[model samples]
Target chain A: MRIKAIQWALSAAVLAMSASAFSAPPTPAMLSNACAGCHGTHGESAGPSMPALAGQSKISIVESMKGFKSGERPSTVMGRLSKGYSDAEFEAMGEFFSRQKPFTTSQTLDRAKVAKGAELHEKNCARCHVENGKEIKDNSPVMAGQWVKYLEIQMADYHSGKRKMFDRKAERMKPLSQSDLDAIAHFYASVK
Target chain B: MTIDRRSFLKMTAGAGAAGVLYGCASTGPSGSTADVMPKTGRRVVVVGGGYGGTIAAKYIRMMDKNIEVVLVERNDHFVSCPFSNLYIGGLMKDLSPLTIRYDKLAANHGIKLLQAEVTGVDAASRTVVTSKGTLKYDHLVLSPGIDFRTEEVKGYDIATTPEVIPHAWKAGPQTVLLRKQLEAMPDGGNVVLSIPLAPFRCPPGPYERTSMIAMFLKQHKPKSKIIVLDANPDIVSKKGLFLKGWKKHYEGIVDYRPAKKVTEVDARSKTVLVEGLEDVRGAVVNLIPPQRAGQIAVAAGLVGADKNWCPVNPTTFESTIHKGIHVIGDACVAGAMPKSGYSANSEAKACATNIVNMMNGREIVDFSGINTCYSFLSAKEAVEVTGVYKVDKEKNTIIAVPGTVGVSPDLSELEAIYAESWLKNILIEMST
Candidate 1:
């Protein structure tokens, strides 16, 4: 409700902004305009190859952006993007994306494949990616409802030594097969 | 791996769209269940899926959930005309990042992405005729960009033959061709680049191109020299900075000639005759010819008082020449905005807003947008120009807000880094 009031006030402020030298400040969504073409608007990406940023925990969003900015984390596009915003802006964006309801596209679920993935996830990956889609750690995002292709590729990339942030993640992921990856992706996708 | 241009565009463009609307491409709504579009809904047919059209299609869906949006484009993949100069300059290697398909728009926004040419338009009945079939629309938007005035040059028509001379302006095969010729030329050879008159897309682009190529030659072919022949009397944008750049780093390797026009070209002889000067001979010739609104725009009767371009109401971007038809991007003659990617993007937003408002019977709100264009002086040093615009009701055109106009006072490496991020951000905004 307060966000609505702020929006109304911003719009009213803009009506008189033209009379002054500088225009009204950009709205959070407007400030997020740079990310729309690739990341999807309001952080809900339609491309399965890319992860949706919407509805994630604010801590994960802020930490990931900060990590990319400081080169503690690596990314092709995100690293460059992280440098463009300030620490305050990153926190604000974290809040903005978190506030947005996730708009994930539904895929036809394979009941057998999902069951297989759930078993594997519970035995090997449950310590990090918890049940019910919530993370115990602040840096890890909720894996439920993520684009399936993004998850599959990330898994394969991690195992094949393409993307690396943790030696421990590699140890756990190294033994997984192609079907195992697919099943795991579907398992989380099928989660509510 | 060896997919032809057409099929490659189709597959990559639909990489994400395959699961949802991929079947829509092979047939109309009658043949496939995936192509279902309700007959009762309001439809918007956008011709050309470049910056202006894509943004308009996405925004219409965002602002009003009920409206049906269909984007008609010839290419399955979009190749950004911006940042292509970097490809030519050897600063960038891969063109894969520049190519984007329509998968995300279709999957996320419920926009129908059709890969086909717009053959004709029945303006009176609001019908867009395409290669596949006809689509009826409540509103039609044309962002078909620009076409080179090939005939204006005595020896060039982009047909029959012109391989020896390449424009490299439209960001396709020509961009690749110019780069190859530059790499092949001997270190001692002379390279000539011709600049068309004002109002061409990206007023500072020719200068930026010259700088990139000079930077490339400075690394690989150190002995070669670049002579820039300008039809306009001076640098069109960032005049002082470009002048300083030419004098500072490129002093011995770069030559600048102003107020000189290319009158004739003999590709076989590798010569271009410049006004008031001797025949300019070169191993490579980058000729940016006179430009006009793209063919589709002219075909749809969107051109108005300005014979070469489309005249749109500055606020709404609706064509003054044709009601119910709007034009944006480089095709429209915006009062003060340069024909640039940033300008097209801003125009698309305003155009989309007014479009939704008009459909809802809401009063039109006044608006114009902003543009910030950067030019690299070298591989590391860069400068920028930015402006804000508002509608002038009396003149019926958008003009730059006078006091807000800004240009970088000096060159900086930081500005160059910002320039790279700017391209990255823009690509993200237009496509994913």
Candidate 2:
């Protein structure tokens, strides 16, 4: 009788542990997967045009999704995606993405382009992005390893007024020359 | 510091005679000099010299001169939240313009100002213990302000902060540090600014900072963009104005986002992970985590067990938790009221009046509240919305009265000049 009672107790403990783990769900991993297209493998984006999403607060993230869905927080790409998720799902998505690991980009560029980009980047970009593009970390997108094509698209968009987003910085970027834009994008892509 | 018996008696006689004469003079003309003159020898101790504390201290002197006021602040100087964005944008040369000096408070206003951190408060004892000394009070007012609660963020501490990313909420070194970081970043470098959960000091502050940084980037680094990872779904204040500014100014340059929270920080690899997205990497990261009441608030048993802010009577700004200890500013759970300087100023005035009535054995009247939050779209143009509020018995929170608030749509040249002037006037009103 004692042996049977002990077996039952052990079985109950195992079941309880497994049940709790299962109920928690893998929300962060799921959100991370969905975010990879624009935000890159980690939280790094293709260029300065794409935003970093590594370490934002859960409340801001959830609210932003609701805004995009409701058309309060305006976005060309996110507004559509935001419509697909409910409040609970948005919350879960924010929670999940907020927890995922921040990854460095994999893109690289030639040294000559980097040298030229470095000078221009220092003149205009360093004021907010941090010196050497290495300081002031978290939530801000990493320019390293992002696709050159994606960077080019964003720059052209800013120049041609395709993506009209909120920020004085973006408006300032709209008037750059093609070579200057390419050089800076390549420089950032080579940060890693 | 003790006065002799003879001098005390003489002073008492003079005070009594003056009081009698003043009372008799009240029968004369209305708004007479005697009627407006301050009653003498009343000393008031004001804790926390932020928006609330500064306004209370300055107003006390402005209203009357007889009462002696003492202001205790942890920091030597205060950086204004209103125009800090300009500093980040590189459109301005120095942040010193945003800082208000308290030297004039003592010299011009005759306020006894002390720079010290309050460590403990004894409600029964009616004494406040600071690093310098214990202070007795006729009525005590506290506005200890805010501090971040980092427990929510994994693998992070104060030292690691401002090293990778700077949360320049409190100003001072952090503000300068953040500016330095931005100045050094390459043109196309990745810059991340993490927005913390709601109920933090300055609700629109993080977004404003983001805009300023974007302004800097737009001019110099066309290839660089800002990724805003916010914990809220939408923008809170002057939403339309910010959107308009972003669209017209930033255009395709900004990758704006909301409703995403950043849960962790990987310092070694310089990566930030959003729950549903791939790892976001940054050449630079500004991780703004969650926040709670400052340490002094919690230490005084002002905060609840849930670790949220303390509760207060909306009309009086007195602590619901402890009697004789009023918790003002960002430390209280005043619902629907975003933590801003303007709100704190209004709350402080109401709190001061209530304290005066309590001391004088007069009936305290309940008052309506007011708030105005102005956001400068740039150095030149600004937008604002004002609201008037009263306590709702049904909801137990401050509710807006209908038709009390309206946004400032037209940014006329005259309004722009007024906005700039208002910054200086308000700063003086709070500090002097």
Candidate 3:
């Protein structure tokens, strides 16, 4: 009886030891779950700083991607991430995100900041960004529900000669101070 | 207070399922198919409850109201590995912020969390076989994270020497184990910390950990010394700030040794055998060995390069090695990107969108992502690394979106405040 018990224990131990030898493969969604750290849930930016990818144009996404991959555009993390995917995947991603609805960015905008921003926007951004920053012309994205923080950062990027844009309208804001840019962003957030 | 809305849902099944579930979906507990919404043909089973898995489960449900989502993880409460260094550094005592209950995610987003160890995967049948039972999935999302390549370190086996020389790489029991060993070690003792090369999760994690340990030693065990045996030539990420930190603060306490690879271990004697240097003995050894894809990823034949890591299409994050299996986290290769929680969370959001679109037969489009990592040099001072990433067609990889990679100008107390805020917001995203 003692011998039998020892043998049984030995077999069970061996089975358990061998069980950890291999692990199953994970899914694509599991692989990509790492992005929620900063981007927010479902690619919706709740932190009021990051851009919302919930609803954006496919062409805009693809063009930005092409720029990143080719080194025409420079990014800290995106350049590395762009190098990870195949070309077809970029088009597919553009389609996927474009199909989703936009996240409503309606955090209470500071009235003073919005008023200051509106003054800046009237002098600089009203050309392409039409009345009240609502209707944007020439494939420009609607800035109404966009994150104020992202807008400020992009403006800084343009001013620093980091990102080059064809829009002459952005050139006017190149001379604005950080406070002015913040005011403009606050105004944009309040538009909707 | 816990609210039971199932009785109310029972009364209002007449309203459109989508409308009734709109914004108020957290009514059921996670786990058991009977408890969650009825399973339709559209279903996704996510493995590993880390940043990637949880984000996928939550986002997929948010995308579609009727799609039943099941998340399988071994642990009940989710622990964040991102801020665990603070806990080890003696700066953070309350561990409540690092952990999140799945009940909130299930109750709020209508997700089913299955606490079980997955045993096997049948790709053809689209079924995940777990210890509890088998589950059929229309789409299988695997965010199993990373596992160490233990065999690389000769004479050190996790099974045998787990207690004496613990590697608290994972954020759970292993972390506490390492902390206890550090606490128990006598003053004037030596701590030998071995760090692996790149493609490992959190390129800057090992350095941050070194700083934390050194900080603890300064406060409690002043005479103790920490020898960092780095496999890389120098500090891999956030170099200037860390080098400055070492010079300004931990100059005498830390013995930084770059280009020294730990090859072997003598657990009984508490010694680590380096490639070029003499065997160094210590009172405590934190050996973070070279890493690879989770064992499950290798077993499913999804791994590449001598079964070291998995290669997936950067677009969909689907395994190039397998038909339908998608791999993420520390398991797969992302070009020019470090495997960090920030990177994982970014990837999870994109992958979730792709999976939902593919399930509904909607068109898949391209999207860019970003990662921002903040490493603390001390309890009050920190630095940062932030960047934007996008898919490159000509290179066929995920690349940066042209000139946005920004490292910190210098370590600052303000950056430390930002770091804590980042952790707080990330925890909120994971839990609620």
Question: Between the candidate structures 2 and 3, which one is better when assessed by DockQ?
Answer: 3
Worst 10 residues of 1 chain A by lDDT: A15-24
- After superposing candidate 2 on the true structure, give the runs of residues whose Cα lies further than 4 Å from its correct spot: A1-192, B1-43, B61-67, B393-396, B410-415
Order of the predicted models by lDDT, top scorer first: 1, 3, 2
What fraction of the reference structure's interface contacts does model 1 contain? Answer: 0.03
Local accuracy of candidate 1 as per-residue lDDT tens digits, B1-432: 222335433543454332221223433444322112333567788888887888888888888887888988989888887778888988778677677778887778888887877765555555565665556677898899998887777777586434678888888788888999999999888889999998798899999898888888888889899999999988888888888887787877788899888877777878888863579999888988888998877776777766689987766677776656789999998988889887887788777776776666443555546676778888788887766666766665788766446677788775676566566556655664
- Of 2 and 3, the candidate ahead on lDDT is 3
* Model 3 residue B293 lDDT score: 82
What local distance difference test score does each model get? 0.73, 0.63, 0.72
TM-score of chain A of each: 0.77, 0.59, 0.70
Q: Please write out the lDDT profile of model 3 over residues B36-64, one tens digit for every residue.
A: 22344567888888877887788888778
Candidate 1: where are CA atoms >4 Å away?
A: A1-192, B1-40, B160-162
Return the TM-score for each candidate structure: 0.67, 0.61, 0.69
Clashes (N, CA, C under 3 Å) per candidate: 6, 84, 78
For all predictions in the order shown, the interface RMSD in Å is 9.6, 24.5, 11.9
How much lDDT does candidate 3 score? 0.72
- What lDDT is obtained when candidate 1 is compared to the true structure? 0.73
Candidate 3: regions farther than 4 A off: A1-36, A42-192, B1-40
